[model samples]
Target: MNTPYKNAKLHDCRDAFTATLEALAGQNSDIVAVCNDSVGSSKLGNFREQFPERLINVGIAEQNMVGVGAGLANGGKIPFVCAAAPFLTGRALEQIKADVAYSQTNVKLVGISSGMAYGELGPTHHSIEDFAWIRALPNVPVIAPADRAETAAAIRWAAQYEGGCFLRLSRVGVPDLLPDDHVFELGKANMLRDGHDVTLIANGVLTHRAMIAAALLEARGISARVLNMASVRPIDEAAIIDAAHATGAIVTCEEHTIFGGLGSAVAEVVVDHAPVPMTRLGVPGVFAHTASANTLLDDFGMAPDAIAQSAEALIGRKG
Candidate 1:
């Protein structure tokens, strides 16, 4: 556990993502970046300036961008395909499945401003369904890092790993939670704070909120364990089972939907392994209204206090 993250400075995971990519490219000449003309949003401006020839902007054609990434990987060059989450996952899902997942290419799919990060841009821009869309496919490890440190680590891990991966990133600023030397481990959940009353599991932007919710529960004499579960697919089944048996109850909070996202993935593990009283907090099964990213999350009842309340309620149903 790092220092109590109260009032810590905020950081966008994309900045750390691009910075790590640049540093990795410095050492490996086979690394290349393919994007749907998202240089500014993907934070690849510096990378474009550093490696002018290596940055391939495939205009607004997301499908073509993914195909090009696959081709680059086929040629033994590592390709980080960057684009808005909605377009990258929604528009080019077919290409992602056939070219990257089925072919098992070494392509890094970076979904910039995922979840409700583009909330003000309406539901069309919101990429909340990405978890279900990509998690359904094989040969693709779905990951969403909780902080900049974890973001950098996951990026580095994807660079060295052999197969395809989906790194879901948010543009919304969040305080760092993990230590500076934190390493990216696939299918492993990091327990931020331990408790026996109820477990709060979350990742990406919701991990910090889970920490705060844990503190709030503690203040009320309820012990809440906090788990930063960055990997959605290849989920930490052992940790989820342990949390269920140890805590007796669990509450999953995520920026995506409760239907088929982090919460759904965790529930699938819990249902098969160890059944527990679980409440998934996120955008319910409805299109979200236009609002700021944080405002939409709060509106959908994923605020820290709301999460703590959900955890407390779930504990009551434990049998």
Candidate 2:
């Protein structure tokens, strides 16, 4: 496995998201979009042009946007609540918990420009804590799709899913790792590469990075397994357990904070079922500085080389 996707084309997941939503809207009259004045950032211009009346823009009001999404779902309309991730989850978390999750509404919460996608906007706009925030609620599935294919698949799944769910999407361009026909299933992890020395787990934009890291480890004669753990909440516990037992070491890399996110979720599973040597790479516990998403990620030691190094070190500690 020496980098099969070296020449893969880069794509913005937002394009796949909006395109998929527009297609779904054409078929389902009940499908609607609610936003917090984020039409451009959410890339809903075409959607608005096609279905003007269905696009509800609650100007700059995050709480009201969530409330309206819930109201629409109650009125037999499927609402995809689109907004910036920080405000969508942080400012209106109460509405998300009370109106959607607790009430069990069929609201599709699409957090656009999540993670450090807001790059230069600093920590105020960064949605690093979203996975932790939404995953703590009941009746909701938290997902961060890895590529364009996965993003479209997850959006299609959300449209049909009964209960409330959060779909965290990054604006950063990423290569298509999953196949076009890949179907997204809830709470399951996709094993991209298999090995026996160590396991590399990640999601969202970090999945491909993990693959690159696996290739780096392979070059150094270390067999590394790579897992795309997109479904964060009901994570693939079985996959995590198997990787732990098989590889004896685990390294989780995410665009989120080290606490209460992808790393924490994997660690929870490992500590519960099979204890293993692990390393969690992320923001570690601080507000990220003003920089591009990838720059901040590399600065925080999430680069492929850093990930490979962490995997090598963790493998050494596996007693």
Candidate 3:
């Protein structure tokens, strides 16, 4: 299946995130926004203006911010902890494990500017390892919304869901992938296009690229299926197996490192159920040099053309 979504108007997922959050906060006073001096980045200024007291700015302390979120959850208040992805996962991994995951608190851990959205800032600011870090812990459903619609839907879902969850969002603009009435279903994959020759799976900013890659594959006389996989932790194993069995080959892409990100998660499911020729496209276990997000993606062979080429190669290995 090939769709012309790349040319659609782009949207920043954070806008949808804040708008949905503010609307939800209006109905539920228990909702709160917790951040580490990231009001501007997280787009929580409007949220702060609407509900000043409910917005908790912990200021520079990532660990303390997460701990505070856990405390708020304990006090019967729903806390949406927001911060840069690297600091959120790298700096507060212990607190996330002890106060949230282990305690099973009803806190929404929102990792803003995830993946290479902070591109050009340098590798230290990049959050390529967040998926690996957060997914290693149990009881936390890791998710990355593909577009603004999905972001808002996921935020709404997180508000209603109990316990803890990691909502990985990016500042990069993406065209609307899912429909406006799209409802988020955890552990379920959205089939953007149906094909039987091969499967192209991706999440976050890479999803649009995957769609474009599917189009490119179609131009070359290949039937490429496209899947937008948002939930990384509780991935759609059934869809993965079906794709593997039907397609006989797979190409997985992500904005995170290939070592333990979306590609790795899908590959795990494929090997266990229906082993097939697979190619994982991402930062191949190396700290990326300073460059724009799109440049880095192309450099790592995650650009649409590169992805399409890799899919063709993977399909060649199919027996």
Candidate 4:
């Protein structure tokens, strides 16, 4: 069967995130954007221009920015602490642990340019460690929306969802992989294409790659399941188990380290519930050399063809 979302308009999920944040802020006076001098990169220019009072630029201090966000949350304001993913999650990790997660504050950590979005900018800028970092913390739901529609839905859901949450956004453009009005349900994986041979699981930018990989598998007479799994922390255990039982083999692709990211998340579920033959496609644990984000993904064997090849290889190991 053909996928519901085949060829669609490509869009940067960050644009949808900013647009939704601005609209939500207009509705709720308590909604505010706090960034570490990343208004332009985070694409909050229009937001800053519209409501200057609501947009707080903390000027390159990620730690202080998160601290301020926690303070604002304590004062009954919904603060979206936005910054580059590496700095926001890596630099202010302690703040995220103590003030936001441990304190149980209602602050939304908006990680802009997450994953390899800063590809070619070097390892210091890439946020390949974000998932492992944030997922290790308690009381924070780590989310990476699949596309623009899911990004908007996840933002809206985060606004209404009380307590702390991390919304991982990317500047890299991706084709619309979900329906126009898809709603994000926490811990639920959206099955884009179903097959009995093997399964391809991914989130964020890799979701589109997984879909393309599934198409390639179909061309070779091997049916492959495609899953858009955005919620990494509260992973969809049921779907993971079902995929294991149905497909007998699984392939996970992510724009993150193969050690402890989306692939690890899915593997945990499969290992605990139903152990199945699985292959993970991602950057090996190594500081990447200078290359564009897309180039890095392709280099690390996460390109669509690479993912499909991984899936094809995994099928041979299936019982």
Least accurate 10 contiguous residues by lDDT in model 2 = 1-10
TM-scores for all predictions: 0.98, 0.98, 0.98, 0.97
Give the number of the best model, judged by lDDT: 2
Candidates in order have lDDT scores of 0.93, 0.94, 0.93, 0.91
Where in model 4 is the C-alpha error above 4 Å?
1-8
Q: For model 1, how does the per-residue alpha-carbon lDDT over 188-233 read when each residue is reduced to its tens digit?
A: 9999999999999999998998998888888899999999999999
In candidate 1, the residue pairs with backbone N, CA or C atoms under 3 Å apart (3 or more residues apart, or in different chains) clash, namely none
Q: Stretches of candidate 3 above 4 Å error?
A: 1-6
Q: Model 3, residue 192: displacement in angstroms? A: 0.3
Q: How good is model 3 by TM-score?
A: 0.98
Candidate 2 TM-score over all chains jointly: 0.98
lDDT of 3 by residue, 206-283 (tens): 999998998888999999999999999999999999999999999999998889888889989988899999999999
- Model 1, residue 301: distance off in Å is 0.9
The root-mean-square deviation over C-alpha atoms between each candidate and the true structure, in angstroms, is 2.0, 1.6, 1.6, 2.3
Candidate 1, residue 304: lDDT: 85
